[model samples]
Target: MHLLEVRGLGIRNPETGTEWILKDVGFEVGEGEFVTIMGPSGSGKTTLLHLCAGLESPSEGSVFLAGKDLAAMKDRDRTLLRRKWIGFVFQFFHLLPDLTVRENLELPLRLQGEDPAVHEGRIEEILDALELGDLRDRQPHGLSGGEMQRASIARALAGRPPLVLADEPTGNLASRAGEETMRLFREVHRRFGTSILLVTHNPRDAAFGDRVLFLFDGRLDPAHALEGPDLDAASVFARLEELGI
Candidate 1:
């Protein structure tokens, strides 16, 4: 089964009535594949992510995750499914202020009624992988922007969810840090067979994915989806320029 699928998905801004933010967006990500969606600012990239996560209802069409239809499920069931199946990394690094880095990383496991003690080996592995060992005892407020983002990604992966949804995860970091963050995503995918769906405007960020999709003006442009040598960052940016996107 596909890890995630979107069929003719459309989302309209409730406040705006007739205007559609995303229209007829459709795609699928199979198990262990890394897929990216790139778009300009305000191009509905985050909105599409929200729809995939079942955090918002689409005005039309459907989203299915692991063969379960999101629009057909009750809100509580959707919440449970999300807890069990989806790990999300946000651009803003939504760490809890009162929780220590260790605590923050353990929060998802705790929510799922899993004991952190049993996951110590895995947690240590993540800390080492993300190079976050030094920041374990610190609070979110004490870390640099890149450090916080790394912690956020670690937290998302700690649960070993089948699919990870990242919305501009590196958008807040410096170029080097952002590149490092993308490397971590690739590493996790390679080591654990995790499926990742990342959305960002940055071409460098999009290049890391197995498949690259470009979204603009509320539509996913097929002409811009890239693979092979054409999937590099330079190629993606060049396509964007060629398309006047």
Candidate 2:
């Protein structure tokens, strides 16, 4: 079974058009798989991510995480499921400015009712693995763009959840930092076998994934999907050019 399945997803609302325009999107991410959804800005990528995370209700179709329909679950149950099963990395590096890096990593565990005493050591392991050990006490405002992103990654991996959804994780970084971030993501998946579904418009970034799916104007054309054991940036860009994405 797929770890994450999005079938025929669409947005709905009589007044707002964000829901009115997107329709019939579908895809799946297998366990231990790394997949990239490549689309230009305003392609409904964020909306799709939100739906998959159960942060929004779909107007049509459904989103399934590990065989459970997110929209079918009660609000509290869905919240608990998300807290325990999904890790999120966003473009903005949503770390709390007031909290230290270590504290930010611990927040998700605490929210899930995990005892800090037990998870603290695990968080340390994550910090060390992600090379954030010395910077763990620094607040978000004190860190560089790269450092903040590293800490965000550390926090996302704190619980070692099975599935991670990253939206333009390297979007705000410089070329060198962005490369480092992508390599870090690849290493994390290699070492931990975490299923990752990342969305980005950059071909270089999208090429890091085992498979690449193209999204244009909020729609996925399965015919344009690229699959390979070693897909490269050149090929990804070629596909994008052909599709005019």
Candidate 3:
């Protein structure tokens, strides 16, 4: 079964009944697939990511995560589903300022009511794998941008969720740091076989995915979806230029 699916998805402002952020969008992500979405600013990329994460409900269609209808589920149920199946990495680290690296990485498990003692090995594994072990006792303010983003990625994967959603994860980092972050993501995907759906404007970041999709004016431009040999940083950049994005 598909790990994620969206059918005829649309989002409209309920109050104004005029503003629509998305319309007639449909797609499916299979198990262990990595997909990247590229779009210009104000094209609803973040909104689409939120919908996929079950944080927002669609006005006219359905979103299915792991074969269950997210739009039809209650808020409580959706929250549970998100905890169980989704891991999120945002543009900003969003780590609690007061928490140490280890503490930040442990937050997701603690939120899910999982015992830290039982999952301690997993936490350590993530820290070591992400090369954040040396900074484990340090708080976010003490770390570099790359280190913080790495910690954020590690925290997101600590749960071993089937799917990970990243929104502009490299946005806050420098070029070299951004490249390292994308490399880390690729390595994680290889090692864990986790599916990733990321939204970014950077062609280099988008090239890490198995397929590249373009979004324009709240809709996915089906004609420009590129994969295999056709999907690369150069091609993505070229396409972006062509689209005036």
Candidate 4:
């Protein structure tokens, strides 16, 4: 089943007036598949994720999430759809400084008017699974970068959304921390069968995905999809360099 479908998508910055940030981009993500989008910085990788999540409308073409046309929905309806089916983990942890880790994790459910009694057990399970129980009372500002990133991911998963859009999820972490986060992502996929679209410039990160997509000038090069021994770090980096990343 196709969870996401983007056809001939194009996005342009009205301010630049010169070029399309994303042009003629198209792809489909199957149910429960982990897909990595790789490109150089400023190559519209993040822009594509934003479009997938309906945070921004494409300048042309269509974005369909779970068979629904995102472009045809009003802003309020789009937001509600995203809340019910999509989760996002951004490069920079966007936790609120004033809220404790537990509060931050609970905010999404609160906004959706989910009953606290029904989710309390699930919340505890997630905290324990993410190793965040001890830091539940801590504020985001007090935690290390890795911890903050983990908490951000925990919050995204709190609602158990079917599709996850992660933007450079390990960008701020050290090598070990990054690998740990990737393991967590894999665990989430195995346990929940959630589909993920992860955007990253780092080839090392591509190893986590079932399919790696090379995005150059906002277009996917399907010929470069990685598998088995072909997914070595050297090969991945070489491809990124070829794309001028």
Candidate 5:
């Protein structure tokens, strides 16, 4: 089943009257599918993600999560829906610096009013899955970039939300670290069957997804689906060039 669907979406920056960051964007992600949104900087990839996650309202069009129309909901209802169903990973780690990894991972469950007894076991499961068991007691400041990123992901997954939205998740890591993080993402998708919508400019990272869509001037180029062997660095670079990015 399609977990997320967007149609006729458009976003405008109020300050820049001429700039429509996303224009008539549309896409769908099925359960357990890892789809990548790729484009150059300022191409509205992040805006598309924000709209999908209901962080920002679209100027035009509709966004549906699990068949519920986000634009039709009140703010409070939208907030509740996002909390219960969506998981977001930003480019920045966004972990509370003072919180230990264990505490951070538990925050979502606590907010959801899940029982503490269950949280303990769930935390352990996530820590072992992410190979982060040893770092659970460490604060964000004490962890490496990759470790912190993984912790952020762990926090996002703490509630076991079905849909995961990651915006430029690998942007700040070194090449090796980024690759490892991408591998971890694939592993998570494979094991948990979570639908992921990843926004990224890195071609190598985008290539990891089951399908890729190129965004330019706030619209998706249906003609540019990147899949299979066509996802090479050369093809991605050429598409970027064609988009004038």
Candidate 6:
């Protein structure tokens, strides 16, 4: 079964007249795969990512993770499922301002019921992988934009969740840092065998994915997918140009 499945998902702006923020969106992410969704602002990229992550419930259809429908699970069960199965990384490193980097990582681990002292466990592995050992004690404000982003990514992956949902993971950083962050994501997928669904407007970010999907004005077209060994930044840019994205 796919690690994550979004089926005919749709959400409406309750304040408006039948306006759909996301209209019948659907997709799947398989185990150990990296998929990127690219779209312009207001194209429903983050909204779709949130729906898949269970951060929001769709007004239409359902989302399934590990074969269980998100809309069907009980509140507690869904909470537990999300804590253990899904990881989230946002554009603005949503780290708690007062918490140290280590504490930020620890908070989720604790919530997930994983002992931080499990030696050679996910926390340790991720810390080493993200090179955050020395910055672990620093508060969020003390770190560079890149460092804070790395810490946020580390927090997302520290529990070794099967699926990581990222919304504009590189959107707030300088170009070099953004590139580094994207590379880190690629490496994390390779080293941990985790599935990823990332949404972004940057072609460079989309190029790192095993496959790419384009979203246009809250609508997704499967025919717009770009995938292959030739899926590089240049190809992604060309496709974006062709689509006038």
Which candidate number would show the highest lDDT if scored against the true structure?
Answer: 1
Which tens-of-lDDT digit does each residue in 1-245 have in candidate 5?
47899989988887886678788888899888899988878888887888988889988999999889999999999988999889989899899988899888888888888874666777787788788999999999988889999998889899999988999999999989899999989888987887899989898888889888998777796677877756666777787777677
Better of 4 and 6 by lDDT: 6
State every prediction's TM-score relative to the real structure: 0.97, 0.95, 0.96, 0.93, 0.94, 0.96
Top TM-score prediction, candidate number: 1
> What's the lDDT for all of these models?
0.92, 0.88, 0.89, 0.87, 0.87, 0.90
List runs of model 5 lying over 4 Å from the truth: 229-235, 241-244
TM-score, model 6 to reference:
0.96
Per-prediction RMSD in angstroms? 1.1, 1.5, 1.3, 1.7, 1.6, 1.3
After superposition, the stretches of candidate 1 with alpha carbons farther than 4 Å from their true spots are: none
Q: What is the lDDT of candidate 6?
A: 0.90
TM-score of 2: 0.95
**Compared with the true structure, what per-residue lDDT tens digits does model 6 show for residues 93-135?**
8999999998899888788776777734667789888989899
Per-residue error for 164 in candidate 5, Å, reads 0.7
**lDDT per residue as tens, model 4, 59-176:** 8999999889999999999999999989899889899999999999998898899865689988887787778999999999999888898899889988989999999999989989
RMSD value for candidate 6 = 1.3
Off by over 4 Å in 6: none
What clash count does candidate 4 reach? 0
Number of clashing residue pairs in every model? 0, 0, 0, 0, 0, 0
lDDT of 3 by residue, 39-136 (tens): 87788889998999888778888899999998778899999999999999999989999999899888899999987779888888888778898999
Q: Which portions of model 3 miss their true places by more than 4 Å?
A: none
105 Cα displacement, candidate 5 (Å): 0.3
Worst 10 residues of 3 by lDDT: 221-230
Q: Which runs of model 4 end up more than 4 angstroms from their true locations? A: 228-230, 241-245
Candidate 3's displacement at residue 203, Å, is 1.6
